[model samples]
Target: MFKIHEIREIIKLIDQSSIKEFELEIEGSKVTIKKSGGVVEEKVQTIVAQAPAAPVAAAPAPAAQAAPVQPAAQPAANTQVPEENLHQILSPMVGTFYSAPEPGASAFVQVGDKVTPNKVVCIVEAMKLFNEIEAEVTGEIVKVLVQDGQLVEYGQPLFLVKPE
Candidate 1:
């Protein structure tokens, strides 16, 4: 019989190693561990695994844009104006977007909320873990680009803000 301490030690060593999966059987007592790299990657992967919709959501935009809309019809001012005044905080990785830390929790930021560069704007829940997404721009949140539980792609815009 493997003691609890021994099992823990095995897990710790397995985590530090490059092996992705581990399984062992001794006298009918079995142990299995599936690793997803180190601690930071595990946290990020926990969220990304649930965001399979990310790629689907990304497709078709370019095709649709190429159909009927003339790029020249959009004035340069309109294209540049918003970007000049507003900054967007984009997702650092693909995940399911969440406005709050947990169910029934108050959202980290709402429309018109003032935020600093390091403020936590929202939490993105991927697999079963919630990763806090921060605001990299000091500004007032003008719009939220994603809904709660929405699947977001890496670099997808989450919030648009009017920079202070």
Candidate 2:
């Protein structure tokens, strides 16, 4: 029979090791442990010489349901824009925004520059990976909302574009 102290010791050992799975069997008692990446799962199983049959019962039928009715809703929400006539290009992820590819290099796109959908506008560094941001709409950049090496939030406006 495994004691509480033995189980604690085993858990400590498993925590200290990088091994993902461990099993032990002694005197008809079995223990199985598994770890996923850094998560730990402990399971214990005991086998008896004889097992009793379980009683069965009939399950009730599910209740009848009605179909849902669609409600009339507004198709679009309106946002009042300033007189600048510019559409905002928002950041898709939270990271450090960079205007240029490298230090002292010219920016990928500048204010008053025409940008196409395929044009690379900037780089955002997240989790040690440098991700290049692309312009999704073809337009002329009217304003840069963020500075180089600045920390940006998700969905924050990075650039303003004036449609051609």
Candidate 3:
């Protein structure tokens, strides 16, 4: 049987690699893990075998669910300016978005704040991994599209920026 920490370590290692599926069998227990490309959704399956004379059974594990969908509201500023002139900072992976580094802390960037290419604008936590997201461009933040702790999808726009 694999320890909790060992399982976490394995997940971390797999998360950093390009492998899509991983399976391991130890003794009479089997573990199967699967993840999508650029998305953090994970489904883990475990199966246990009984004595040689008995039959093996596989139990289906509960699947991870994405955050509840929120209705999109149009910002007044977006209507005034042409969106073609603005740049969108998209989420690179599926995860929970956090504007602040921690609870009650000031957000990394707010609307009207200037950001450079390497400036960290937020964090996207997936499968217990906190990924720092950068601005990737020099611009003034025009709008924050997602709320804190909201689940974001891959390629979804998180911020709108007006290029400096």
Candidate 4:
């Protein structure tokens, strides 16, 4: 998911370049960005694969929502929502998310799976290196938020856990 900051950078790049439109497609997800009337319009569409490349869930595009642009001396509206009672396991780096250790391997955890601090919950592959991601909170996995092979940004929520 492109963060608001990333989108801003893209807009700046577009404004400084001759390109009027940009589109990127990965797997079943597509992102189309266009410039209109000094405003940037981005349409992202994603289809969740039932038998996901692995047992992972889909990546987050909706979480990339942008806040209203504000001029200098003004503050933008806060768009962040707090996940109460749910401990979130976040990605530590920008990488491709993986639910299993390797191809054809079963996933590390699923919804309803119980986990504890330091327990490996998934893998994030960065630059061909696989880094194990741990569940920091003792809890029951309530949700797996990112798909296997999905590109995830640093600090992006990967799983939601209901604390024990």
Candidate 5:
């Protein structure tokens, strides 16, 4: 099931982008978001395969929600400088984010850490494949957006850097 924050983030991103419709289906669950007349609407649906021997409980389907699009607010810490000045490191795929190489290991990068374009900043595990994410900009890390082991969506901002 998709978390509320995740759904909200998806909606926010869609509102900021030019895409009018977006859909994603995973493991029989589907989420669709559409923008119309300056309003955003989202529908979430879950499908379950059932066996004849045992019946599953019937639940009411979720209804689509429409919300007015609003400009996203910048975090207090990041408001010091304009967002245009910060370089955002974005995820290339949907996956779970890992700060360290393995359990109990030190994080690859931290706030205030200087990084080069080739620096491996984190790992994103998708479908059992661990992909190393690099800091494509030469700068000092300014913010770590997502927590360790958090599920991240494609194009999500993983880190913000102040270019040197």
Candidate 6:
């Protein structure tokens, strides 16, 4: 079972660390932590073993069990530069920052790019999932505060936009 305080601590760690993704294996259980848009999300899975009935005691002993496998968690994608002189766009969740949907892909928005409210300017990945972040104000991109794949904290400045 995942405890709320533990999760909060993990989130705080993620916020403070430069690493965007973190994983741990404990007692045959796997835990993964990711931060995006200033939000931290975690996933935990426990592997349980079932004992065989007495009737099977005579059978050859089962091969030694292997260590539990942790699922491959994908980090968040996309980070956009907000314009200067405009309201700064802050991360709402903790996760990895991406400049594009994938490696080698063009970024969603760039410096000098015009943005409007409701336009998806970036994406924050949490818990192996991608979440699109929209621009909340109409403006021109001025600066990018976070680098791609960098871990960000809650309320962290993502971009500085200049109003159009």
Order of the predicted models by lDDT, top scorer first: 5, 3, 4, 2, 6, 1
Instruction: Summarize candidate 5's per-residue lDDT along 1-164 as a digit string, tens digits.
Output: 76667666555554443344556677666767655554433444642221112121332122222222222234213536566899988877656889999999999998889999999999998656789999998998888888888766566688889999
Where does candidate 5 stray beyond 4 Å? 1-79
Per-residue C-alpha lDDT of model 6 across residues 41-127, encoded as one tens digit per residue? 333473222222222212221112221222213322333433233577777665677878888999998877899999887788765
lDDT of 3 by residue, 55-161 (tens): 11332122332222333354313435577999988877666889999999999998889999999999998757899999999999988888887766556688888
lDDT of 1 by residue, 1-164 (tens): 55667656555544432334445567756565555433322232121111112112122222112111112221212222365578878776445778887789998998878999889999875435578888987888877777777656445667778888
Score every model by TM-score: 0.51, 0.50, 0.57, 0.51, 0.55, 0.53
Say which candidate scores most in TM-score: 3
RMSD of each: 13.7, 18.4, 11.1, 15.3, 12.1, 17.2
For model 2 the TM-score comes to 0.50
Query: lDDT at 81 for candidate 6?
Result: 34
Minimum summed lDDT over a 10-residue window in model 1 is located at: 47-56
For model 6, the run of ten residues with the poorest summed lDDT: 61-70
Relative to the true structure, how large is the alpha-carbon lDDT of every model? 0.58, 0.59, 0.66, 0.60, 0.67, 0.59
Candidate 4 local distance difference test against the native: 0.60
Model 6 regions more than 4 Å off? 1-84
Screening candidate 4 with a backbone cut-off below 3 angstroms (N, C-alpha, C), the clashing residue pairs are none
Off by over 4 Å in 2: 1-84
- Quote the lDDT for 105 in model 5: 100
Model 4, span 81-154: residue lDDT tens: 35587887887755678999999999999877899998899998764578999999898887777777766655
Name the Cα RMSD for model 3.
11.1
TM-score, predicted candidate 3 vs. hidden true structure: 0.57
